[model samples]
Target: MVEKRATQRHRVFKGGTITFENSGIACTVRNMSEGGAAIDLDTTITLPQSFTLLIERDNFVRSCRTVWRSDRRIGLAFVQ
Candidate 1:
């Protein structure tokens, strides 16, 4: 597959949260880069198209939009 990401991703396994409109869901940071991330969510339930991803361990919080999804994994692009 062609490399389409703006930044190279680093593998990770940090716990995180996706929050939107008073709703929050648990997730795991599977990988990350300057522009985006891949996360594994605990549920297959639908999520808002836009949300905030908070990874406390990394002291990171980003506004994200759904890029893709498969099973419980979601690909997100950081919103600028």
Candidate 2:
């Protein structure tokens, strides 16, 4: 099955961290837009059903929600 995603994506890479219910892991912001972001986390870090993503990019700290996830990665979207 093909996954259909919104096409308004921005090619921005930023460094950040992720905190889940039980653990906190370091991740990288591979690409991001106003709507969502693609993050690269460790393979062993299991993403929770919902979690907070703390993004410290270019002197801006933004928090978002983990909306979708896979084995070693996750998709985050703005909360508000």
**Superposing all C-alpha atoms, what RMSD in Å does each candidate have to the true structure?**
1.0, 3.0
How high is the lDDT of residue 77 in model 1? 98
Model 1: what TM-score? 0.93
lDDT of 2: 0.70
Every model's TM-score: 0.93, 0.66
What C-alpha lDDT do the candidate models reach, one value each?
A: 0.92, 0.70
Write down the lDDT that model 1 would get. 0.92
Which digits, one per residue and each the tens of the lDDT, describe model 2 over residues 25-66? 788888777777888876656555556676655654455777
Count steric clashes of candidate 1. 0
Best by lDDT: 1
* Lowest lDDT 10-residue stretch of candidate 1: 41-50
- How well is each residue in 3-63 modelled by candidate 1, as lDDT tens digits? 9888899999999999999978889999999999999977797888788999988789999
